[model samples]
Target: MSDITNAYIPPAALTGSMRDFRVPGGIDLLGRTEGFFKWQNLRRQNGLWPFSRATEDGPSTVCSAQDDSGNKMRGVNFASQDYLSLSAHSGIKATAKEVIERCGVHSAGSPALVGNTSYSVKLERKIAEFLRMEEVVLYPTGWAAGFGVIKGLVRSADHVVMDMLSHSCLQEGASAATNNIYQFRHLDNDYCRNILTKIRAKDKENGILVVTEGLFSMDSDTPDLVGLQQLCHEFNATLVVDVAHDLGCLGEDGRGHIGMQNMLGKIDIVMGSFSKTFASNGGFVACKSRAVKEYLRFYSAPATFSNALSPVQAATVLKAFEIVESYEGRAQRDALMANIVSLRHHLRGAGLDYYGDPSAIVCVKMGSEGLARLVSRRLPELGLVANLVEFPAVPKGAARIRMQVMANHSEQNIVKAVEILKTARQQAEVEFEDHKRPAQFEARAVA
Candidate 1:
């Protein structure tokens, strides 16, 4: 087989009798599926695929996780996005149980049908009040909110300009919404402005949508919301900001990136997910006009077709909103910031390359995919759990271990996780070196 073919085919596929099958051609849908399986197999061989490690306990500082081999290991969890550590809060749990008892487990139907309960309405009101928006609409999941909003508002005649590194849901929504989709460089307001100006020159009639995230989870970075808003106004475009990663975690009263940037109530639309800090699985979109909210309610697929947010989830998020607006929430945010600072300091002192600003997430650069996968596999064994981000998720050669810090993580837990990570890095480097030497020797022998 040619080296290119060998590079594409996984080691497992090349073993045994499977190597006899011819490689697929073209980048069609079937070919893409075949490529995905091939890549998945390669990741599996390197212990990088099947990343859904089951957690025994809820989102906490530490939890019991099952590895790929089904072996349970208790460790400091740096993989969860529970920024305020509210997912395991006793009050949230109790509220969920009470709501379930009163309203049953399911919503029973779509909100347009029989699903809009008093709990849902109350939660919507509370969220709108917290964000200072005129109205709020809830969705079954964050992905649905992103997808449904874009698909609902923008048609094929409309145009969408998004950040290059926006979440997949936003990108998918844009793709589904319009044919005219443009992407600016990550966080590059000038590039976005240029794109908008160029598009406006040609299509002055169609609606234009500019989409971005309040905080990018992978890079743990935020955009210049004020600048983006200015550009949108100048170019006559609507701006939508997704605060899934920042809301309920940053800014005073958890108003998130918009508040931090002092652009709250300035953007056209604001959306966020509850799973991060609200200790529940759902999402919402807030807007200034009741007309927009009503339009989305009738046009959005999730609102019109999908089942509504369950009563239990609505109640949990409502209680979470109450807590987030309280003094206790400020204290939790302070603790989370402290943990971030502590972990970043340790990482810097160790002479490691990390990315992004101070937030709940800290990404330790690994430089290569092999090193990242190896280190990630070793972390579970070292009593630490972190997420390995590599190619496709991030640009090639920018692999890293993304660590999420929680408000509940003790100083000891932070320090110990850093120590364990250092050890894992060393072990992975040694193993990588050992593997590279053998592979090099075999290649030279074949040559």
Candidate 2:
């Protein structure tokens, strides 16, 4: 028999990331993917896989959930991205039902043809007004909007200067659009200025697009928009801000950092999604020029080839915006901020550290991936629901639990989640200390 046993998976594999499996090694196109499968299988068997989980019931502060293997769970939910808790709002539901009855469920065609519902057109106008811009183009998802905007406007010869920690959609979109891409240090305006100055000094003929986020979800922080905008203006570059995480649930009038920074209509391009705050599945790109909007509608493959937002989704988002701009919306933001404060306060009191400024996304640092995976495995069993973000999302050793707080989360939910998380981590720490690291690649079955 071979020296390698049935349980012999490489030690490198244990420490490996999805990044390693991205490029296939062999010539067989289909079979090249098997290594990743086997590695993933190992993670599953070890109870280390924590992705693709499902919810058994409708969303709320607490939830009934299921893990990747279908193990049912119920707990204090902090995994969802419903920052305003508007998904369960009565008005939103009633509006969705009414639109489904009146206009049916399908958007049927792309917006370039027969897809633009009256509701969508009005939604576009309303969003433009809300952002104090002139025109808006809608997309099926926020990701698509981010991708479409860059792909539509930028060319292969043009340049894209982006924040190092920007969302993957923005990064992928920039990659898709051009090879002349530059990355500035995260939230470092001076570094951004240096890159912009270099680009302008060398290539004054082509376009340059600067991409950033209103609020970075992973770090729960924001950029100095005014400074970046000034750099963009000085360099003759365009700026696009992705407001996916903070648009409707943050700031005084719920305009997110854009309004908070007093750059409402001054931005070159604005992109956001309804999923985070509007309680629907849609996205939009707003800008000052009718030309940019028209150009994106036709040239953007995501918008041109995909079905438009359904009338119900469009109407639901419309109603969400109405509520988002209302007095009730202010109360919701206040409540969300209150919950964020409570969670952070209690986490500190309990001797845990969290990352970033006060916003809905609270990233509690958990030092190593080994301990984090153990804690993740123990959490649902401990009656808490949260997400463990490890290597490839954040740095390899800087694992964290990304808690998505909501306006409706009760004080009890916050306290209980913190306690359960603390308990789970303590238990994992004990197990980690006792278990001594596994042999590098032992010739033994996991059983």
Candidate 3:
């Protein structure tokens, strides 16, 4: 069993502290926010936070980021989730510009009102057709789509069984929608089957929703979709698969893990984000029936209350969809897979341990948060911009440097990145050893 199974905390236990007014001495909302910022400030000061810094250059294979010292430094970028490098594609940018000029910038209204334009409608249709679903609904962002799907479909009496390592959006949705939520071990279909069986035995009337992701971003792994679908069928449960990281970037036709598992239309619902591979900042849910789609559209708060995808966002995604289905998309996927293979081979040859299968995302195991942070901080200086993921995202001791491969990255770029990473790792180890010696001596002196 993974550490998530032992350390995972339900979302309900962590949300809505405002209602607990009777607590004698507890952190309020503002206090909680302040605490987070304080910690973030410390991380930023140490060059460990490494988030939301301005990028002076395009989000390509190699890009420039403004450092804390206000220096623009170019590096091999493996932090972006643009698996196909479509975000910087000339055709996508041109379509976005054309659509903005034609329809203006903002929708200025919720999708349920006047925000649903022809571009969004046509994009929805295109998505449905591409994913082999009967209908589709769009959201302003991917997080909203995942959260909306559960809250729209499930009620208080319903039950939700999900993977322990599922996305925060999915967990939050389940927590908000229902109280009877159970999380199985990560990627453990047998555990999921047991949970479903127990739940079905107790409640035969209320609905049961089984949720998992097409690809777990932090761990860089996937679940057995076919097996999970079978279990859901046996228990008369609905299966919702979030393909945010894999859709339009994986499988033979870029249909994601579902296609790879030969369970595309067999699953109850398919949902994903457009930011990763579709070259826009939005999300969608594809289902087999118009009635279900309409119900979600009417009930999902993000769809009903939030402004819809702007014309440019919708058009860019539509053009990206067209490109993804063309020969160019196939070539891109080939290049992406080749890059992943090459990087993994190099890492292994250098005696480094990595997690996950042959996917665009690869995680080098760093064992501890301190080591991971040190390595990540050193990486930018070594000409690599990578992400360091630690506690609350993964298990306590399983910190790693998450690297994302792109189709635009050449062999030379990958080789250079790996070499720099090796050097960074060595430097981090030395720094950590030097930092630890003082603490060890202090403890010894105290004893």
Candidate 4:
């Protein structure tokens, strides 16, 4: 999190706030406004801004919004992480149907109590194999995996050194452990190395876990896995990577970024989500060591207290994995990347501001929170939908429209979506001109 005091703002020569606007709230409102203005300016500086609206509702198509008249909108979803188009896959549906027929719905109790079944074991084994781990533990959600893994692994006396921009789960996990925490600058290898050096000298005997994400969620940037892995090895620190955004899309055979970066054996714990790429709900943590797996099963709260995934969800994800492991998987992965490249080219050609290496996810920073939300609301008017990130999720003023590409989005659909964005940009510019004050005031002549 950026310090409120040190937050970046745009040059006053750029966008200026209306001094006469009557704000309903007091200092809180003013502070919020200042933060928003700052965020907008900073995003503009980085050339990252956009909004999301609704589009279609099918596999390989984007869904941006749903209008009040039961209509869809114009925005192409650049905000979804549904990489494999599994949400609408027939195979997934059929497998889920089979599970429903065989086991009915909902686990009757938590897994540690009574919800355990052969299905659970089967799913766990499949997940472990898919990620090249010896064992895997399931969680109710991706956040749960992060939280539980941290709490389960780190003791009160231990320290956790993490990336500054790590997800909430990583932060919460560290908090759950102890106050002995060190956060390195985002994606800065030198900063990470310095932290490791400091930790080695200051807390030599203390247990340490170095955590980072495989692909950063907001910016779609990948960490230097080779450097990080080497640093972890040199410092004798356990390395954990959350591949929530990179699984099923980046790795060879969709194993994940760890494998993609060839950091497989070097990484100690691998965490990821099924909700995004797998088109299912749940989270997982995989490790090569059986002892770590056993420890997590007993010590992890989400694993012990929470119910296992329903038979249908388990079946659905299991089938999705099968597709991911097959020749069809290669086809889908290529299609997904192709779409990603096409959309990226469109955005870049249009001179739209965006961030990170173009892959599955891209975030467009829309100058200000107001503009970001306005674009979001307007995209649906054009028949599209996307996610608007602001405040706590991102920075206070660093709002953006985050977009995700899927294997299903067709070339025609991509063209249509880009055309809509171009049109919307023109309209937005016209409105901004109509509402904005003139650049200079003319000298009043005596009548």
Candidate 5:
């Protein structure tokens, strides 16, 4: 061998070794030892810590479940939009079962082409009557209905006015048509009027479609329906109210927001989801006139291409709707409200940072990605699962967890969840204050 002093190690050999070990700081002798030790510690910490897994493998609370080391952790299902607990209802199940037995699985064709099942037609008629409209069209999903209705009604020359916080589907459907889409402040009728006036002044020939939701899903707030309807009429704008979150939970008879406000005649188009109150999958666009119905049938792409609601799905949703329209149906809605009020009182009394609105949905504003993740992990340990929404779903710094109140969840469950939230927030405050990052947790402060 040549003199040892002339020896050299190839960079490629070192790189290969480093890649094998995955040592941070590129595997300098001392750094390699430190990195391995750090890796081991992290592995142990992660192994012992709470990670949600959907499988029935670990202790679960309201928000999390843990599987094995290599599996994806399961999230507690507070993110679901099922409001009336209809999906789990016995009557809906029985009806669906019967339909499946009688009509088979799918309708197997598009409604416009050949797939107009008897159940689908009846459901549409029932939905129309429920919304106090003369004609309605069914779609594959609520988003499909939303997309079809917006794209069908608005023209390139028309101005579409939507709530700033409207769903992505509504925004996308309108935006795809033209850049003339105007978004007004959430529930601000005055803003709507001013924008409509401006649009009418400059483009008299253009039509205006004023769109809003019966319930603002995020904040659990209601729109100023009476005021909005008045503005729409005065400005020649057709009002389209999307009742996805409110269909089964609001209204006296659970007919939805327009029913509660007694503005059924004032609204031009009413769209809703069967997934929520009806306890099934599909959506409908209820309108007062056959002309609009005929136009929607011919023009709406979603209605044209989307499969007709399966016979089973239609039957299930119809049964749920029947329940919703009955006296007992009204009781369920009232019970849901009672639960909401009880939850609001409990959360406020516990100094929890919940939105506390008197609606079907409640939001607990937890600040920071780290804290939201931590709480989400801890919540399941307490036996309650909720949704931990972080950046992108909301704003960067405004992470929150949303919960929907259903007739299925008991007062005890609500109270217990609030208690756990209080304890969790108190623990977080102590930890974050010690770490000098207390400002990252304003949600706890709001509590």
Candidate 6:
């Protein structure tokens, strides 16, 4: 097993992080950003920073892209979020085109006003029915839906108990909604129970929202949903599961962990995004209460203030749901699962360590940010396209390569990806050790 706790001694220029530049010292808020820009630019120039890379084509098993430096790259893509390969499905694309011709582009207003197209309404109902819940509200993006649910339901006096590894949307929503925010260890149900007990013991009058994810993207893990939900019931709390990464791709019926764990229609709140497996740009929150749905529509700033999901997006998601509910959906899920298993098996055979259970996400542990950065720099050149997860996303030194498996990824893609990844890592490891020698020599000289 690899020690994920290993830290790195980066060069003096790359020592600090974006986190270091967050707090402003001077009165000028805009000027405070210069420090972060300086740090980020250094990373961009060296190909160490991998954010904001642009893809030349649509979603596929292979990718052609350009990094921050605008250098061309063509490789096997393992960074896309399209779990079931639904983005390019003929039905999905056709629906988008048909809706665009009929309804034009924009929704014209927030959903709070006249933005509820027939497609949006149907999408909400379909999600509610699929989840076995009573009502649902739509949001412009997955992040908005996550933030809105907590921000709309919980208030200043309420308490939010969450898993420490919950999505940033949930955490930010909790932060924005109240001051009494509490987090337990990742997937630690007993720790969650303890937090709930402590919160209830001190204050039983306020509302409590317990937040968790169906599938954590970074770690590729899920919590014990049943246990967490039972704990919520015992403590008079509401459990909101973010199914952004797993929904529409996992489980027998594609209800994600909530279904696999026999939790359908039982969760207090269900929030998810269409961007992952649904092949669209929208999100939804489903619950058993109509009142709660209405409350979120008006009170959730994202829904009330932001423009509603475009008609084309809503229609595209509707078509995706149509496919996800049919026999074809089951086949797609099976295909996706097969790819996930194959990729994981190959990764293990390559003598690489990955964290968490088998899912669409596969986080291959890299141990140190320095080695990971070098490996990332070598990947594109080695004919692979995978995202490097490092500081701010994970612990500072606990970097990893996050591979998102798609149903369309063939055996060749999986086999070749692992080969290229291993090659890149080997090349980077040699370069990294040599790069460390100078710093080590300097320290020994000082000694």
Error of 6 at 251 (Å): 1.0
Residue-by-residue lDDT tens digits, candidate 4, 57-150: 5434655444333444444555566788888788888877878888998877776677766777788999887766788888878999999899
| CA deviation > 4 Å runs, candidate 3 | 1-28, 67-71, 439-447
- Winner on TM-score (2 vs 4): 2
User: lDDT tens digits, residues 84-130, model 1?
Assistant: 98887888889988988888899988887888889899998998777
Q: What are the TM-scores, per candidate, against the unseen true structure?
A: 0.91, 0.95, 0.91, 0.81, 0.80, 0.95
C-alpha lDDT of all candidate models, in order = 0.83, 0.88, 0.84, 0.73, 0.72, 0.88
lDDT of 3 by residue, 304-390 (tens): 999999988889999999999999998999989999999999888777889989898899999877777777777776789888777
Off by over 4 Å in 1: 1-35, 438-447
Residue-level lDDT for 384 in candidate 6: 92
Model 6 whole-model lDDT (C-alpha atoms): 0.88
- On residues 19-122, what C-alpha lDDT tens digit does candidate 6 reach at each position? 68768699998888888887788777666777788899876889899987788889999999999999999888888888999999999999999988999999
The true-versus-predicted C-alpha distance at residue 296 of model 2, in Å, is: 0.5
Per-residue alpha-carbon lDDT of candidate 5 for residues 1-447, written as tens digits (9 for 90 to 100): 122111221222111111235535554676567754553334324332232335443222233444445434343344445566667677777888888999899989887887778888888898887777899999988889988899988888888999988887788889877779999988888888889989988887778888999887777777889998888888888889999988867877776777788887568888877776677678889999999998898799888877788888888888888888888788888888887788788888987666535777888887765455445545555555666665455556566767777766677778877887777666555543433444443443454
**So what's the TM-score on candidate 4?**
0.81
Residue-wise C-alpha lDDT for candidate 2, range 371-436, written one tens digit per residue: 787778778877888998987888788899989999999999999999988888887787554444
Candidate 4 lDDT trough over 10 residues, lowest sum: 438-447
Instruction: Give the C-alpha miss distance for residue 264 in model 6, angstroms.
Output: 0.5
How displaced is residue 6 in candidate 2, in Å? 22
- Best of the two (2, 5) by TM-score: 2
Per-candidate RMSD, Å: 5.2, 3.9, 6.6, 7.9, 11.6, 4.1
